[model samples]
Each structure stands twice: as structure tokens, then as C-alpha cells.
Target: MRVFAPLLALGLMASAAHAQCGGPFPAFVKGLKSEAVAAGHKQATVDAFFSGVQQDPKVLKADRAQGVFQKPFIEFSRRLISKQRLDKGRAMAKKYDATFKRIERDYGVSRGVLLAFWAFETDFGGFQGDFNTLNALTTLAHDCRRPELFRPQIFAALTLYEHGDFDPARTTGAWAGEIGMVQMLPRDILINGVDGDGDGHVRLKTSAPDALMSGAKMLSHLGWRAGEPWLQEVTVPADLDWSLTGPGQNLTVADWAKRGVRPREGKLAQGGLPASIILPQGRKGPAFIAYPNFNVYFEWNQSFTYVLTAAYFANRLEGSAIYDAGTPEPGLDGPQMKRLQQKLAARGYDVGKIDGILGAGTRAAVQAEQKRLGLPADAWPTMALLNRL
Candidate 1:
């Protein structure tokens, strides 16, 4: 699941309305109620859904404080794919073998991938969050920064409630209004939900089969190719062109082998499928040959660390060896990243904004600066890079 940044400016703008509508929070909910009715939702259903919904300050706090997004890839992966999570995933796989098989046959998605998402999203159904789905969506939609993204979700949640999928009072999940064991958004639930438990209804919170199969359905719809590996841990030659090591640089296996790229654990077949080299921790750390199917991971979540961690976890569940990267140097924290971005901008690098998100533009600027400074242009930001900047 992707974490969203809170719209503090929007919150400030809505302050006067908040004072007028009993409070900004209540005003926001009231406005959503009017919009819901105008959008063809039954008044009764809307009322019932928002029966006791209130603006949760904690939701805003969680939205604004997404620390995991700023962590280094290895550290994030270690925390996400722990031995406990792996063991529980294996147990769930064994316990629901038949359901997984059925889902695979129907959706052509790997069971391991589904389990990986489930484990990472909510600890394999252990803790799917405690925020009210209605309140969260309403709060987000009322905010201006991502109103376009959350408004539709609010309506989708209302539709689900009207269709008797789950009680609004009981429908709880992440701060971004993601429900179910796999933390699916309300829009995804309305579009890609599936009845995997043969219960004639999709209940993602309780039924493992339902959640897993629903997740599989989502991946399938997102263009997951059957029988294709998402990524392979590979070793890139030291003298290879480091600039080619990132997303969108698709090259065939033969092409990569010609450039001295080889799998760390297995031999690359001649004239193999197209794959992109990904240097998640720069040239000093791990390298991977990401296949075309890897795009499905992005569709699942936009965070590169989250996508790689989920893909690596799924591969591990399928009996692949752990990543063979060396210990990476310490990376920059949020403030350090912002400072680095400022330095790069000072050097006339188009890093977009100094928001400290480490997005593609910032990374590309880093790569350019590294090459200019005669440093290894692996594009991974570190404290060393910041100090030099």
C-alpha cells in the first residue's frame, strides 16, 4: 500500500469552514455528505456510513509521518520480510493450499506474490489498522492536495456499503482508506474484489482465501504475466556502464550477458527475455535484472523500496535465495535528503522540488552530479554523497 502525504495547507484553508460547520472536520464531513447525495448515493446509505464518523487527528499524523518510505531499501526490506513474516506466510500457504491452487489456475498469478503482498500490507491479516475507512476517506477527500484521488474513493466506499459488502462501522483499515488483509483501496475493492472463499460475498478482512484471491485478481488485471520472473538477483561487472542501471533501460538477457551481467546464483539463458538492470543500493550494493512483469509491482505500489521488497519476498517464498548484496553504507535521512536536493538544485540540476522524496527526477540529478564529480554514478543517495554535495 502507498502512503499519502497530508494536505496541511488544505487543512489550513478549511479552518474557517471548520469554524462555520461546527468545526473544520465536521464541515468537511458535511460537505462530503452533500456531495454523496448529489452523486446519486442514497441518503440513507450515506447517513448510515457516516453514522459516527469523525475526523481522526491520528490519521493525519500517520499520513504525514510515513517514516518507512524514507528508509533505505535494505533496512526497509529487513523490517518488512522478517523471519516471523516468512514463517507465517509459509504456514498460511500450507493451510490454504487448495484455495491458492484454485486462484492460480483462475487468475494466473503466483500464490507467493499474493502472500508477499498480504504479509507486507498487514502482516498476513495480523493488524489491518484501526482507522475507520469512512472517516479516513472523508478527511482525505476534504483536503485539497489529493482531493481528486480520494473523492472517488469516498464514493466507492459508499457504494460498497450500499451493496452490503461490509458494515461501515466495522470497515477499518489504513489511514489512506485501504481495507482488507491486503490493504486494498476502496476503488480497487469496487473494481477488482473477488469471492475467493465460496461464501458468495467478498470479505477480505477475515477470509484469507478471499483476500489472497482478490489480490491475485488485482495483479492479473494489472497485467501480471504468468510464468515470468519479476526479477533475478544478478551481478554486474565493475566496469559496466552504471548509467544503464535503473528502470526503463530494458535489455535482453543476451545483451546483458554481452555486457558482463550474470545472475548471482544461476546461469542466464542465451537470448533470454527482456529485463532492466536495477541498482537499488547503487553499484556497491545489490543489482537485479528486473523483468517486464516487474511493472505489475509498481501498479501495486509506487514506492520502489516497497515494490522491490515485495518482489524479493515473493521470490524467497518460491525457494529463491536471499539477495546477495554487500552491506551498504548509511543513507541520508529526510533532512539530509532535502539538503542534498537543495545542493543539487544550486548546481542547476533539475531535481523538481526539495520535498525529500528521492523521486526519479532527484535521483537522475544525483546520477548526473555523481558522474560529474567523478564518483560512482549508481544514483543511490547516501550520507557520503550529501557531504560531497
Candidate 2:
């Protein structure tokens, strides 16, 4: 059985979810309260949790406005990883050296990995978000787009509320209801939260150690291999087959090395480690060899660009050298990309959502179409590829 099986069973109940997710706001909250009580939560607790909770249109707006991720890898990474963040990450590492050491020893998650998330999620706790947590959860749960994913989080928050950790009116966080410095969902907190400071509560908002350790524990649950390398910038041979590139293809580091892929700075991982050479831009752009541990990043966030940037930031925090941003071919804009996705979908390819984002499904389809068209299958969609399609 999965963790939180009883709660998860309630979360997946279509009858309750359809009534709660499809009805008017008042009816939705009523159904949710009824379901929560039926799922073993006390009536008083559920009522207090839902008291004054209202749908947040702002959260829905933020959910739909993810266009910032459309930026190219170089642009996105540069925008997120600043000199100040780098220096702050180093200082924060030193400040919490003891806690990080304990976390590394117990969880096998490096400080750099946790620090990168800390820096990105909320600027090292400078801003944990301002949206009311309960309202955000209720808003998302009531929305029809992705109610299944958000419904369980409500109960998890109620669990925290019962433990006197969460405040329905005062607990504020990201628009998506992720709490604390590292922006973890409520379910993640209930499952992987760590009391790093040992004050008897997993306080992620106010305590740096609590947030850092909790974040590490969550990453560990996401399949992060302890003490394993995740990403390394690399140089590829001019004669290497471009068709073998992209995150979809994996080969041993030894195999990649034989194909003339060399590390840009430090030595590569073990020869036996399975790695994929990902060209974030195109054949001429920056390249990196992502190891198995890198796959776990997707469990935290689905955006490929964000995951790559976070992995690269972790490397930078550990003193990795800057990557060479080779001159890559220009990619399509939002409209052009949407057109490409439509074309790919019409061709019977599952380019999910057709949302103009170059997600994994779209990239996979692009690679397949590129290979079929006798073009370099680097998986970076280009105008040429779009025209051919």
C-alpha cells in the first residue's frame, strides 16, 4: 500500500471529487468538509480549516501564467543564478554547516543540492510567499483543471492544523499552496518533513535548518541517490552524431566519452553510470551529461528548463566552472511553438497540452519527427524543424 493510503483513497473518490470540484464555491466547500469529516478528520477541525476560506482567482492566474519558463535555458539560468545568490548560498552553507552536515550524513543529500533549492524557491527564505495557505489550497482544489492533485493537500494541511503547526488565516505561502522556504506541498511536508532544530515541530517558514533538512529529506524520497553526481557540463565532438543527443537517449559515460564527449571542467562520473547528453538549445549550444540522480529532479518540478537550471546551479554552488554557450540556432516563439505542437499532435504524437512549452512529451515528438525528416534529432525545436514538419 502507498503511504497515506486511507487519505489517498478519499482523495481519489470520484463521486466526492466530482461534486466538490464541479459545483459552485459554497457547495464545493460543503462537500469538501463532509468528505473530510468522513475521511476521519474531526468535525471541529474541518470546520475551522474551512472557515472564511475562499477561492483565490490570483492563484488560478498564477497557475496559468507560467510563460516565464518559455525562456531559453541560458536566459533562464542566468536570470535565476546571480552573483548575489551564489555568494548568499555560500554564506548560508557556512551558517548552517552543522545542520547540513547532519542532513548529508543521514539523508545523503549534499548541501549544494539543498542550497540551490533554498536559493531558488524563496530566495533563501527572504520571501516564502504571501498567499493565504488554506485559501490557495481550497481555490486549487475547487478548480476543475487539477483537483485530484490538490485535494489530498487539503487534508494534509488539516493534519498539520490539528498538530497546531498550520494556521488557516495566518499561514501564507506560494500561490500553489506550497509552504515554507523550499516551497513544498502540504502532502510532502506531512510525509517528509524533518525537525532539524529539534524544537518538536517541523517549522519550515521561520527556521532555516528546518527548511533545509526538510527539503533534503523530501528530495531523498524523490529518489535522489546519496553522494551521486547529477549534472556536469561537457563538450561534444564535431563528428558526433547529433541524432544521439537529448534527454531521451541514455548511454554509459564510457560510451559518451568514446563518442568524444568530454567534461568541461571536473572529471566525469563513474564509467558505468548511465548518462544522457542533453543539448538545451541545439547542436551548437551548451551541453551537459545528466546522470541517473538527475532524473529525480523531475519529481520536484516538471519543467525541464527549471530542473536543468537548478542542477547547474547546484554545480555552480560547488565551484563548477561556467559553461560555454555556443551560438545556437534561433528557436520558435510562443505562437510558432504552439503551431509546432499542434502539428506534432495532429501527426498522432502525444505532445501533451499544446501549451507552447517545450515539455518532455513535445521534445520527444520533435526528436522523432526530426529523425523521420532526416534532420539532426537534438530535440531542440528549431524554425527549420518546424518548417519541415
Candidate 3:
């Protein structure tokens, strides 16, 4: 039997759509109801799932206001993996040792990796967001930006509700509609849910074991290789070809060694595993040789900074030393990055959008500009580069 949270009185917050997108949110939801029924969800289930659902302007606001992806890797990683978070993550690993052992045995995922993901996702379950999952998903689905992604999540949530995964009345989570300790989206839960406690049901909200195990299952399905290093901090020689850096360039540890790449604080292990040298903040900041398992982090989160932070946090949990390579130099902030991107595009470098993110396209363009300027072409954006732009 599912134990539902105390029901809050339903009240409609005035839609901010009129001020923003002028979307007919209620009518969109009505169409979703018909679509849900057509997609084989019972009418009663559809109605119940959407009961008291509202257009969460805050959710839409957050969706449109995602600027963190533009943050430099050093700042982003520091914020996500603080000393307090690391200590608490270690404690949690000890507290849940047996459960983690079982999870590793069953799913072949590292305990540290799982704990790092959990800590990063929800602060060790300190607080999952309070937004109603149904309303958030509905609003996002109705919003024109990315309906193709959120619409499927809505169906998955409805299916979870229909099957009693959680009480629909209490289905609250992040504004993006990700739920529970590790913040899995509804579709992820539907596909990778696991009864980690052997309770014959997967309840992520109240069960750390269930959530961690389910997350592990998902990671494994996403190609997480057990006992493989995700990334290793390394020092790259100044004269080495800068084009060899980034995810696209794959080489063995031996090949990297031959190119003057060495472990920052330790000896590189002898292996033939192909790895990519990633200079997250260009050559001025830390460099890391990312292994095959690092790709799984991309599968977990598309943001380059986010995946690096998670992988680095996991390494810290396993007692790895902090990175000893170059420090992040003063660099361009979001607006400056946007200006630089525009400059690069005007120069016919195709830096994608002037969205302020130093993604691959923007970075590549920065490299091209550096080469044209007769500067070291490390592909990292600096305030100096922005000023030149």
C-alpha cells in the first residue's frame, strides 16, 4: 500500500504565460489528456494524474534561465563538489556499505560513482525540489521549446502513476520533472527502476537503496564500465599539438605519454585503453585524460562541465588527490562569451549560437581565431581573447 503525503489544498496560480509566451496552457493540457487516452492510458488515470495541475511559471522560468552551463569548469566543479559535500558523501558511503556492495555486485557500477551522482543530484537526498511533477512536465510539454523531450516524459510519469510507483497526489520533484534522490527523469525510472531493498517495489523518494540501485542500473545500461578509470588528471607539455586535446581526439595512455602527457601527481598506468586529453579550461587550466567510462558521464548529463564535475567528485570519493595541473586563468563570463561567439561567427568560424556557452563549436572557433592571431591555439576562451574580439 502506498503512503501518500498529506494533501495540500489545490489553488490556481495565475498563469504567467500571458506575460511571456501567451500560451493556452489549459487547452494544451486538455489536448494532452486526449492524447494520453489515445495512447492507451485509461481516461480515469489521465484525469487523476493531471488533477490540480497548473502552469508553473517558475518551472518555465527556470527552464528558460539555465545559465549555469556557461560557467567555467573550475568554478562549476568547485561549487558542486565542496568539502562538506565530499565529507558527507564519504559518510554516506560508509553508512550504506552493504547496500552499495550489493548494488556493485548486481549492477557492476562503482560505489563511489553512485554516491557522487547521488550527492550531486540532490545533496544526499537533503532536498528534492517541491514543484509538482505533473504540473512541471505539463508546462514544459506545452512550452514550444522542447515539447518533443518533455511530452514523452509526461506519458512515462502517467504510466508510473497508473502502476502505483508513487502517489500522484504527492509526485513532487525538480522543475524539470526529475524525481527522487538521484533526480532520474520519469522515462529513466520507467526503464531502469529497481527494487534494491527487495521490497518488491521501487520507491525512490524514501528508499536510498532503491534510488542508488536504480541509478546504478541506469548507469550500467548507459554503458558504465566497472573498474575503469573515468578520468585522470595529467600535465600536458606546452609545445604539444593543441589539436590533440578535447573529446574527439582518442589515443592510448602510451600514445599520450609519447606526446609528453604525464600524470599530474603520479605515474601513468601501463595500458592500451584509448583515452582523450581534455583541457577543460584550455591549456591554462587542468588537463585530464578521459577513459571510455567518461563517455557514460556524457550519457548521464550532456553538459561537459557537469560530467567532469561528477567524474572528478567520484574520484575524490576514492581518495584520489586533487588535480595538480594548471589553474584556471581569468576568463570570459557568459555575456563576454556571447560577445566572443558573435565575433567568431562574424569571422565565419561558425560558433553555433551566441548562447554564451563555450561548447565544442565555440571552443573550436576560439582555437581557429587563436591560430589566425598567431597565438597558441589551445581552444580555451580567455578574457584576453574576448577583449581582442
Q: What tens-digit string does per-residue lDDT give for candidate 2 at 1-389?
A: 01111222433244643444757999888888888888788898888889889888999898888887888899999999999999999999999999999998998988888899898889999998999999988898888877777777888888899888899989999988889999888888887888889999999999888888888888887788999999999999877887787785889999999999999997999999999999999888999999988988887887899999999999999999888999999998999999999999999999989788998899888988988998887888999988887
Best-to-worst lDDT order:
2, 3, 1
Sliding window of 10 residues with minimal summed lDDT for model 1: 5-14
Order of models, best TM-score first:
2, 3, 1
Q: Give the range where candidate 3 is weakest over 10 consecutive residues by summed lDDT.
A: 1-10
Model 3 scores a TM of 0.89
What is the TM-score of each predicted model, taking all chains together?
A: 0.89, 0.95, 0.89
- Which wins on TM-score, candidate 2 or candidate 3? 2
lDDT of 1 by residue, 191-286 (tens): 778888788888889888888888887788788887667878988898998877788777888999999998887666446788888888788788
Superior candidate under lDDT, 1 versus 2: 2
RMSD of each: 4.9, 3.1, 6.8
Error of 1 at 277 (Å): 1.1
Over 4 Å off, model 2: 1-20
The lDDT of each candidate is 0.79, 0.86, 0.79
Evaluation by lDDT, superior candidate among 2 and 3: 2
